[model samples]
Target chain A: MMVPATSAAPQSGAHDKVPLLELEHLQMLFPARAAAFGGKRGHVHAVDDVSLALAEGETLGLVGESGCGKTTLARCAVRLLAPTAGKVRFRGADITSLGPRAMRPYRKHMQIVFQDPQGSLNPRKRVRQIIGAALELSAGGSGDDRLRMLLDQVGLNPEHANRFPHEFSGGQRQRIGVARALAVDPQLIVLDEPVSALDVSIQAQVVNLLDDLQDEFGLSYIFVAHDLSVVRHVSDRIAVMYLGKVVELSPAEELYRRPVHPYTLGLLGSIPIPDPVVSRSRPRQLPRGELPSPIDPPAGCRFHTRCPGATDICREVEPPLTLYPGGHEAACHHPLNVSSSDIAGAVRSPAASRSSGSVVPVPPGG
Target chain B: MTLRDTGTGHVPVNESAVGVLDVPAEPYAAGAATYRLALRRLRHNHRAIVFGSLFVLVVVLCLLAPVYARYIAHTGPNVQHITEVLDINGKSVDVVSLTGVPVGPTWHSRFFLGADADGRDLAVRLLYGGRTSLAIGVMATAITIVLATVLGLVAGYYGKWTDGVISRVFDIVWAYPALLLAIALGVSLATGGISIGPVQINSGSILIPTLVIGIVYVPYVARPIRGEVLALREREFVESARALGFSNFRIMASEILPNLTSTLIVFVPLQLAHSIILEAALSFLGAGVQPPAASWGTLLASGAPLFNVAPYLTLAPATMLVITCLGINVFGDGLREALDPRATVRTGY
Candidate 1:
């Protein structure tokens, strides 16, 4: 179900003009294995027709469960993994097809903050060496003042520069990782679950640090996360993905307030709200069945089997992303309204309405 | 910085405690912990300690070879050697000097193992031979490590054509048997007499053999270093270094090479032992150190014929050779185990 355009109010600001990064028709497909004797093979669409854009100083949150192609999308955005079929335009330049030598200059402009901080840093190197390596690689000036300033900026003492990664706490090591990423003075950073491996308390500290750094540097971030709450706070616009396709994309506040897609509404409702009274008062929509294997995703809509708003159309023909009134878009044959009414008449059968108290609206002008 | 604040308006500070009680910052430094862990791992192996001590003793003996020579000289000729005595048939009779011989018909007062076919004091030769063997082993291993490290670092870090060329070269060298090539080089040198000033030496001498042996084993040392470099190149720290704008050379040397120290330490002793053994085998085959220039291999070769009559000659040199190799092998094994991170934790290092 596509979001109705009336509900999505366009923002009035100069910020809408400049996009930091844009991806069009991003598709990464892996060759499928043949049968036991190589009889027949099918392609696995790991990432199919995914598109999103980030504005300067804006954090675009990409949230998906495992195997939803969230990580692959992130890697492709930073040019770590080549996209099989897509146009990755960074500042209006197509970089998807650039060779290694040609991509060197872009490497400085874009950086990635990996999920596993321990695996990311060299175990044998000192903190200063790890942070300073990026500077030395880009042929940046290496004055003592410059190095010290970076260390201080990351909230690490300059004197602790001589220490190796194994000597530091998980939080400190992650800070060092951030410092390394910042060394290149990158305009955009792809943070792949930066705080997923840290303690809850440490996660908050890191998230706050990231917010502060973003403001200070005017950097754009593609924050990939599994946690909805965390993504809501960091992201200006959040995209929810399922089975290699974006099921929903909307502004963070709007998406949380009134999610049009059944899958998205289910996700938000499943999250236990911090306020006990509001959580008990609010309606919760828990999805049934496990996420299907990506190798053989559903024929029509990948989430059709588990979607609460699934219909004959959702089972036979995939719904294209329809723009909602408030800039929200969702791919569902039948979508739920704020009052729990179906946007399509498919859910309005006497048998369907009698089975549940939820009112099913007739299709627009049906 | 102010040492103290005025008590009139500000909070009072402890003046005496400021300078006296200094809580050392960053007490858990990397150096102290790494060393501590290494020492802890090393302490668990009893055999390693014993062999390591023996290695130390051998090194000390080689260092004081001059002092040992003087002591032996003061003790006088202890072995009998057949030298410059005419026989009853009017020929130059071999009057065997029992004194200073390593092994002979009679035990000499000071000769521990007796003499060789040429009547050179075997005890004196053993000490001097050790000096040569140890020196060659160390020098060759050093050169091998240096060459291998540089090539490996370049190949693994740079990739592309650099990696391709270095890897191909290494593969070519690795395809050949190192010992066979070393022998061939030694034979070639022997055919072409090499001279330094007035001292002419055969190509089959220890000098040529050591040089050939060192060069042949360079690939062995290099391949491991290349593997290590490749693994380290992908590490986040290396990427961080790149992001920090570090030069490729700086990253390879400071960040990459330093991490490979444990691997190097383990490989060096094994390489040294192999070189020493190869040098001895070459000498025994008469393709290494020429006659009159004493070596453990030469001693064993001469002693082999007299094994039935006087076994001490062969026994003494063979025993020393075995002990030296064993000691080195044990130490190398200990170092390998100690350097392994998983082993370090289990062994309390």
Candidate 2:
């Protein structure tokens, strides 16, 4: 399955093997309200048609703002929630409709670290019981020796284990959560905004702990986050989602270097640069139009209503994901060409484009 | 914000970013179970300790009533020493004063708390009455809460139709005024006793009042337990339990139930108070505890007419009842404060 690519990264080696996990056409629609008469029932399309894959030991970053269905999609991926329709394949085995009993053995391989650290663990439980529970469940029973080893591995003292979650700081709690997930000896872990709830100073600590653990355990991760800088710091490949659809999928460097989708360019423009000098000189251009309701989405591309380069053709028919240089794919009608005349062509100056960095040669082929 | 204008060199270049920082443990770390922590808190509370000790003392007296009666009093609770022959300070003189009833505390011969209208030692009878009242309260609470907890957990966890059916039943039970419903049930069931397929209960059986009181207070305990369970069902920890492949039973028992210790502990003393009062009410109406049993309610009923004569007869049980209920209530309030984990939660997290 190894497919040689023009990208400088070595992740192309993953192409030869079956992905650790793959989702095909996932859809999750929640019932909003029942119709009064014989009318059709209304639904909130939380997660519409979407597909993705995760290679072994690879981190795929799923980036989107809140209400864009990142959490729901993650839930569907791990079978925490059954998708309205889709195939969730784990190493080429379909597990989408597995019953709770059938899902038990698979749970040891797939674990989720939720967004809120305090809420993820039972406050009534002691830290030892919290982490010890996973150890016991996955391995029948575990001694304090293994427990202490796990605590130390996560940069925590064994003495802290007997304390309750309330006594711990936010970063320490997240470390305990990581210890819990690792106790199960999982293959893939879904990190749902793992640092979004932490203070900025502590967020880096947790993120680094997660990165180090992934290498030590050879674990695959679906790191979902709303922060682009954080995602770029971690992900091998980035998939930008909008209104329950993947608008662009590309290698991390290539996507930032040549963001083919107008939506991606607008998102990049929003990240604040620490150098006040550069920020003062940068032009201010926000994305236009309101997000439509998921219940009654606009025709054709869901992003067309807000896309800066959206044309009437984008409004007439939905465009399939089109291939671009360096294996990048963007679903759009009038895609940006490159850095020279790229990103809305009219508002952006080549000088400002140069300021954004990521200037690279046009990739040879898809 | 870390991403600067290309030349700042502050942020990592995509591939290499965010270095590891190990956070050390606090200087003093202690992990204790909520129960042990609550116990430590209770020990620190002077009011709870004093009142809790008083309440325990009363309960111990009630349990050892027979010991206080046979070995110490030298007279059975049913014995009649009507004229009350007594040797006061080595002088053979009856202790009955101007009232023509056996009276005055002899201290010796064990008429310590004095004698009631029945010519029985009032002290011994008070202990026996306290024992009966304690039994009825505790037994009724045990029956009511066990039923309520099971119903509440099932209804709250499996919401739609199961919740509907159980809640409707709880509603119907809740609609009635507690004492009135208790009286009605007590009279109907205890009038001629009850006989099922293989079991038969006599009208005098203590189960009559216990059953009536237990049935009456079901809604009080069940409604709160159900409400707590409903909230807990939405907690992320509960969902995590399910995610970890714990069965519904494990999730409810191990995850949700342990978190409800404060609620359940708070409920017990209140339920005990209610059960005692309800049993007293039923016994006063002659539909509870029957004739031979000397419950606080029965003794009070018999002594009310004697309010003009032997005042101690009426005053003794009424005063004991008030003290017992008050001690329980005050101690229960302190327990609520002591057991509250939220009060102990460290802030600035």
Candidate 3:
């Protein structure tokens, strides 16, 4: 199930080795419940066919609007929610179909940190028991020494391990959550909007702590966030999602410098710049109207309804993720900031070949 | 508009968000376990302590009934003196007047607190009656809580068809008024007795009323517990436990059950009071404790006609019932407040 879209790029040193995690044409559809009598309506297309690869010791930032499938993709990656059709490969093993007992060993290799600090930690349990359960399960050790070490690693006082979750500040409680994920020494940690519930100053501290932990443990992360600026700072590569599809994916700096997809450009434009002069004068490419309901999304490119560059073809034909130069990929016929030479060099990604059967058509040079 | 600079060149922490970030520990709450903290809070509540003591006193006094009857009163609970003269402060008082009016307080050991219409010692009967009432209350509450909690947890956690079945059963039980249901079950169970498999309970046994009252109030306690379990099953901690590869049983036992402790604890005293009152009501209506076995309800029933002659019989039992109920309720309220973690003092950061 590991599609070789990124596999084709051998020169990109990270892709040369087997990817640590791969989501192959993953789709997660939730059956819509009728208003009365538990009847099944049409399914809500939460995560449409999205394929991505994460190399060992890399951070893949997943950014999207509130209703987009970034969080769903993250959950699917960890097998918290098994995908509707596609595959989730961890360390080259197809774990999407593994049963709970069979998935235990694989679970030790992957962990997730949730969004709400307070909600995630059991209020009745002390820090020791909360993190200790994971540690004991994976390593068969419940030593307080190791518990204290994990606490220290997460920038919390080791003595605080005996305390309950509510006694700590929000940031400290979040640290306890991080410590629990780290307890099992997982290689891949899926952070599902971990710092969104925190204050700005505390958010920086937690983000820096995560960065330091990643380097210390050589951990890979799929950092899901709605905050584009935070994702820009942390992700080695970023995937921009719009209504469940990976609209654009590129190297982190390239995504900011030359956003190819119109949706990506709109997301970047929506970020408020620090300087008032630039903020006022800068062109806003922010998408118009609210996100379309995922229950029955529009027929073409899901973003075309809100895309600034929507045309007749965009409304009728679905766009394939065409690979551009520098390993950048975008699923748009009329991509923003792409020159004629760049379009001339583009190739259709392997995962997209089955869906659309054609490369993204080059717009008649305006 | 100005930001304070830190000497270490670190970003300024948000005062409210990171208040407890650097605090070593709470001064007063040093190494306090959650329950220990709750215990300390309970200790500080004057009303709970006072009422709790009162409840303890009532229980202790009732437990000493046999001793009081044998040594102190020199009379058994049902040993009636139909015609006996007693000396009270150099005055001769008949235990039962010729007109069948029972004697008033003799202020003496023989007929202390006076005698009932049957000419039995009122104080002795009251103490013995307390034993029966409290036993029924406690036993019935135990039955109710154990059955309700298990059903609630199973229904709430498994949901779907299991929830559908268990919830409908609870609704069926809830449909009838508590008194009506207890009376119905009591009346039938009273005459026929209860025969479950090899177990046999006699018609006149105290267990009949206990079983009736227990089964009747199940939906009252159960519906709330089911609602709580429903909300608790969806809490993020339960989800987190599932994500940790913990089995469903482990999640329900460790994650869900421990969180339900406070709710269950608060229910115990409240349910005890409710069960006691229900038992009294049943006894009063003659569907509860039968003749020869004394309860506050029976005492009140036996004393109703003698209101003009000897009101002490009815007044004594009524006062004890009110005191017991008030004590349990006040203590229950205090326990709830104490168990609430938010009610305690925090370590300022």
Candidate 4:
């Protein structure tokens, strides 16, 4: 099942607009299985090599299952965690190893809204102090005016300032969280599972609010979530991550229409269609087996163990992320196509019929 | 409460298949601050009111101990009443009563509580006893709270070497029985009158018992608070505060301290009760308030030998001690309810 492509624009068509945030080969490994009796400690490879760039005013949706390093990647993207290795550039300035005091100036330009709305806001703090705290730190404008404006911008009652977080419902609490992030006037906001904790009915309201806020403030967002439809709703370009590495990156519509990697193909097949007539007619071809342990991950392609099209080449050699024309790219030795029998029986193939060389070297894009 | 989508027929018919809408939402709002909420809870607790009143009464009576001794009794606690103040039956106490034997209750006289073997008015001495006992408890509790808080904050906020060292030191102090430890300190520093470098403390000084009581309870206070601060360090709010670029000091004050306020309040009265009861036990063992400055503990000890004759001498001060300690304990239990931030309103919907 494929949604028709809406736009012809390539992902990297314009190079002049420098991305507000860039993460290069970022690696975050939780150090060691602790030794109870002084044995050798082993590293848990939480986030292996990951590289990404996010332009100003663009929302890059990152989709993956739990424990796939999506949350860790969001933290690394916002410079919340110093990566084990790799460069984090904020508008051409390196912030990877900056001291906390040195990172202060950059903090205003980047912010994060946590997953759980009620858990994220301090349970003891009133809404006014929660939002006004940032204002006090930045020391901008009159306190009351700024607080009322923030509350109003997030569609919360100005009188809500006196309320504690537990007094509000999930959606309303999330608005308070958004207001807090907006208080500093940040250019980039990394929203970690922003709507996963909400009711299905309330999820859309928060999504709409986020979309409208993005338009109003010209904010760049790295929306991390496990829901594909929610990601598709707000993102322009989508990055499909598996085991910390981005497996596929393309324009949102293009990736949904024709995903090259087998993992992305399996992911796209799993999104349920609402129409009963069409949904019952199609077969849901989900990937088999549990996600492999990151501590002792299968060698070569991290997805090879669960992948339906795992050839001998896939088990021995890791595939580099190769780009096709129109800014579509995937890291897979065997790209899913019409002839690939393992995918869904009614899978739609890409328009280009030529089966070129399997491996293509990539040039890093700005 | 579960949320329902606002629009049923408002959206275009073509877009009805998908569950998507841009409806405005009204968030829940209440205007009560944390302290306001806690104060409200405190007001509704009847136990807090009753016990707290009892404790206040005890404190006021202790504060007026000197006035009761001066005007009512007309004799200082250390003054020898002899035959002047005591009126037994219809006659004043003669030399026989003053010669180291306990006396019975006197009628319509300054020795309303009767006289001890020293011929001192037990009534005046009882009043002075309340002052010394309460003073030792209050001062020592203050010292224990301050030391525990500072050490706990330092150890918890900065772990590894600091936590390890402080924890080991606490373990060592906790290994010994608290009373035995207090007895050791009293024998060394209190028994012979403390003289350390520039500071000099006489054998009869209340400072000796105060120091002993304060140092003994440090481990108990520090252990629980250390556990709390360690937990607070891992809370998501602290991480969010750091992400917002607030300094560690600001985070500790604004994020950490407010959450810890209830825990701190609950410890105060509990620790105070413990200090007061401990001071009494130590004084009974000759480790507290020396001669000339008699607490309930020391006076009770002096009257133990003459129990067969004038049980009132020991009974009066003993009753005051029991009442004060029991009142403090009940009052402390109610304070816990008052300080608990999440205490539910149980009287009505």
Candidate 5:
């Protein structure tokens, strides 16, 4: 019921500057044969019209359920997966259709961190070899000092380089993955749920390490994850996706406080509050049905079937993201309009109500 | 075991003598420490060990054929004429020297096998034949492995035009009957139609069969290797290597090649067996190793006519061939199973 915080608009002068990485109407479809009792051959909408932008030194959080196309979008952003349609511009140059040979130079500037730390690393290669592989590929640095510096940058001992991946802990392996990405001194890193496979305690350490490294290198990150809390912590701007489509996007504080899109609200509601009393006091709005199959998604809004305020209009036509008074945007026919006072009144627990001031609501339309 | 360290957190330390990291090493746990593990696995596979040992013994014998032939049959001393040494009374003397003339009534020796119908020691002939067989197998297999590795890696890694061209070429080669090509080449060699530089070597010699076998089997070796390359080329590590800016060649050679070691190790022995059997088959058909040189196949061929009278001739060479091939195959199977990721770890007794 809490009103979300409004995101401050960027100064008019700064609006003219180009984004470091930009994807316009990106779509990636995977062709799959129809089921045995099925109608027609269909394509899995792995990524559907996902458009996002990352400015210099910005971390854009892309959160979604599994099969929601976050990873696919991340890959497309880095040109690992070619977009079925739309443009991917980096530094004002369109690189969406760049050939393999042409994309080679751009690879040095952009890199990706895979989700599964174990699967991401080459089991046959030693830690040193894995790290050195990137360095050797990009011709990053010469001599032992730079190599040692790369290792040290990731908080790993340079001496431990000789060990194979099997010899490293999950956290350490992920660090090696990060080290490999950073080998070429890349400007942007598409971190595809880098810490999801690690232990809960280890996740914090990795996140902190990434934060430290980002600060040190002044690097922009396209952080993809399903964990909203983690996304909130790491991201400057957050994009909530469902069924291969972005439902909402806003600054971290504003998105959490005023999640106008029903899917985003459901996502926020699903996060377990540490305080039992506050969690119990808040009204839970769990969506009834499972996600629709991407092969043939719903007629209009992909989330309409699960949207609390879904109507005929939602089913008939997909709503494009409409900018609110703040810089926050949400693609919802019927958006939430909870007031700060209402949120304060609704809270049963004094402890919960005390923290309600920090929650600011984003307006429905610009 | 703590949950943190049990499933995913266990890190293997590289304890190489030289602390140089990134150097490729076998995945077996280091030192005599894990000897127990390998020993246990090997022990459970009794047939494998027995067969592997036998194969090793055969290879060792083939390598030392010159020494054995010299000492056992006195063949090295007189390659032209092998006469059974006689005493003053004109009766054949039983030379006690391991390298002395063959004096036994039958072609049989303790382990040297036997002599041929022409008074040539069968044991010596077998050893000499082994020398030829092993040389051809090793040389031909090396060529196959090298050619297949390069072509397969290039085709699989690069895909598109390179893959298309290599695949089509292999398909064309494969569609042509292998045995027919071998026979055609063998016939060409027989007619002195094919010449290498100044050498006017006869087609019936070992060289012809070796060349025929090598050329025909190149596709066989390349196909399997290509399949492996195709699967591995798309692996995430390969992508990661590319992301790191690794040149295509380095990725193929250093990153990919090491992974295919177990496959190569398993295939080499099988290839050797195949070459040997094929050579013997060709010789039996009168298209392989000519007389005087004395291949097991030629010996077998000679013995076939005398089988009703002296079955020992055919039985002797055939048995040697069967044992050698069986041993090689068993060892190769053992190696394949050992390299298998699904193989259960046995605690050696």
Candidate 6:
């Protein structure tokens, strides 16, 4: 808990400039009732002690398996679900505690596109009403002209604006979702597994549209997905979360080239190679066992149960995220694909350096 | 799979167009197109049309009760003509026989559908009774819907102490069987009537039965609406609305309420049918529509004892009640089928 207060300032140093959005020590815990009578009460630590920053015009990909709190973190960033504890600074203003009315002006600056295209749209409302409602709420320009222009911009026919959402294809509906987010002209848009629900063929189309839209509008994005292959194409920087904690935050190219975290290595290796010979030849690095219950997570490193490289130190004390060259970060006592000298220099926390004697080769920075 | 080249994370603009509708696009026809589509679908349902028309016919005839009484029967619903003689087919007959039995159907302008033991015109009474029954049914339904919708929306949307208080009230009401509750309320209110603020309703007023029947069935309707609202509030669109900075009230009215429209519409006729039956049950037990004024239930009560002597007296009102209830139910089913189009056409890639 005390780690965030001391380490938050240095964490923002990765961005090298004033961030467009910063989430400091964000935590979200859902109170869960006991399954049986007179049982002890507990909280599901969905997101715990996560700090991140997004510079202007940057896309940060959040990659993790299901229930790793990627979606929760994204929602918290947009203020959709207020974090139980944290400071969310958007454009240098603290917005975590702002009421809906107080947050209205800031709403136009950030928007989110949901995962489900069908469920995200009102089925009864016409296409015109669906997008127009957002336009109306923002108090933007003339409704019809702007609506027509939005339809065109998203690559949908303007003439089909009167049709219902159910009448459109899955890809088309997703485009409408993107168009809705863009209607307010937001600077930072959180794409929460936007293309996951789409077909493989249609996924590329929507992803391409999103990519084009970002460059066209000079917008920043937090692209969240479970597939590393999908996130690698659009993300400048990728953050890998494991059991409510970020195990790795690295530059996209550097992460693929040399993944330091065991969880990140497992995720990258899980992506299939098309060539059968190469696919079979490569060692399967998929993590072992199902995800442990979030209500009572593992005591030390949450990934120690699944990590093959787990040692006595990994089982006793959780590793702090150590920064390597070019802003690459990974939290692991025995980091893969890194020199012992690099680990000695990268280890920032004294507690981690003391517990893991392997990195005692070099003197501490302090 | 063509991975867009450029380790710099280039934003791709795929020229593969998603425009151009496969289905022929119609000219913009706005303004409650959903309702229009429902109406079009309803028109194709023969059962709804037939039964719906039957209900309408009953209502129209009930509304013309005075016309039938004055222009045809020449006797009011409560008028007694026991000693009077009527000519039927050129033969003179007493309205009530010498032994105190009422005359049967004269098939003439007077004594139509025969007379009750009191020598009152049963036909005139039947129509007037229908008017009263329909009125109570409609008014009670209106009361139930308005109260239940407001309560359900509030309780479901704001789930805390507000939900606790309102839901407990619903449970208390729900614990009692609807008929028993209505009877209990009806018996108490029918004696002294209701007086609140500047408004007063008489003991024998139809409004008494209406009010009793309305309050009793609120939990039945409200429980469903509240349950639906709970599920609806969690939907992604609702979250999207909140993300857009919509107020709680705005989200409830525009976002949640419109989705609930079909559910509410389907509930209307089913509730109407339920309310009418309950009203009839209450009136039969003598806790409804006092003397002189006639309802189907009261008529049933008055005619049941005279079933052997004048069976038509009982049969006439009973048949009307059955038909009305059946018609509304059948029509409600059709409306549900008509409105249920939530499944959209999935376009194959």
Q: For this target, which candidate reaches the highest TM-score against the unseen true structure?
A: 6
What fraction of the true interface does each of the listed models get right, in terms of native contacts kept? 0.16, 0.29, 0.29, 0.30, 0.17, 0.48
- Which predicted model would earn the best lDDT? 3
- Chain A TM-score for model 1, please? 0.85
* Candidate 5 residue lDDT tens string, A1-366: 111122232311134789889888788999988778856889999988777778888888899888899988998898887899888999989999987788888998999998877667776677767776577555656456777888777777789877667666677778889988998889999999998887675666677678767877888888999968887777788888888877787788788887777888788889878799999999878776898899988976678888777777678766666555555666665667544343333312111111112222332331
- Candidate 6 global CA lDDT score: 0.82
Task: Write one digit per residue (lDDT tens) for candidate 1, span A214-276.
Answer: 878888888998867777776778889888888777788878887777888878877767699
Q: Model 4: per-residue lDDT, tens digit, B247-266?
A: 87788778876777667778
Q: Name the runs in model 3 displaced over 4 angstroms.
A: A1-18, A31-33, A36-42, A353-359, A364-366, B1-8, B11-20, B23-49, B83-101, B338-349
**Candidate that scores best on DockQ:** 6
- Report the C-alpha lDDT of model 2 over A1-366, residue by residue, as the tens digit: 011112222343266778899888788898878778887878888887777888888888898877788889998988989999878999988999999899998888899888888888887788888887788767635888889888888878787777787677777788788888888889999998999988665666577678777878888889999857677767788888788777777787777787777778877777778799998888645578666888776777778888766666567666566544455666665666543333222231111111122222222231
TM-score of chain B only, all predictions? Answer: 0.79, 0.84, 0.88, 0.84, 0.75, 0.88
What is the lDDT of every predicted structure here?
Answer: 0.70, 0.76, 0.83, 0.76, 0.71, 0.82
All candidates in order of TM-score, best leading: 6, 3, 4, 2, 5, 1
Query: What TM-score, to 2 decimals, does candidate 3 have?
Result: 0.88
User: Taking the tens digit of each residue's C-alpha lDDT, what string does model 6 give over B246-344?
Assistant: 899988898888888888999899989998888888888888888678889888888888788878878988899999999999999889877665411
Off by over 4 Å in 4: A1-10, A32-35, A272-280, A337-366, B1-48, B82-85, B94-99, B107-109, B191-204, B337-349
Q: Write the per-residue lDDT of candidate 3 for residues B1-349, one digit (tens) a residue.
A: 1122334344433222243355443333312365687787788889899998899999999999999999999999999888878877888888889998999877677778899877899999999999999999999999999888888888889889999999899899898999999999999999889999999999999999999888888877778888888998877677667677888789888888887787889999999999999999999999999977899999999988998888988899999999999999999998998776666654121
lDDT of 5 by residue, B160-275 (tens): 89999998998887887876666666666755745768976665567777777776777888778888888888777777776655678888987788777667777788888888
As a TM-score, model 2 comes out at 0.83
Model 6: residue B264 alpha-carbon error in angstroms: 1.9
Off by over 4 Å in 5: A1-14, A34-41, A137-140, A273-281, A338-366, B1-50, B68-72, B76-115, B158-202, B215-227, B346-349
Interface RMSD of each: 12.2, 8.0, 8.7, 8.0, 10.2, 8.7
Better of 1 and 6 by TM-score: 6
Model 4 interface RMSD, in angstroms?
A: 8.0
Give per-residue CA lDDT, model 1, range B67-106, as digits (tens).
6656752222223354634233354334344452333422
lDDT (Cα, tens digit) per residue for candidate 6, span A1-366: 001011112322344567889888788888988879888899988888788888887888899999999999999999988899878999789999998899998888899999999789887788888888789755568479999998888888899899887677778889889989988889999999999997665677787778778878888889999979888777788899987887888877788999888889899888878799999998778889999998998866789999887776677776777776557787776778887667556745321212222332222221
Q: What lDDT score is found at residue B300 in candidate 5?
A: 85
* Candidate 6 ranges with C-alpha deviation above 4 Å: A1-17, A349-366, B1-13, B19-44, B340-349
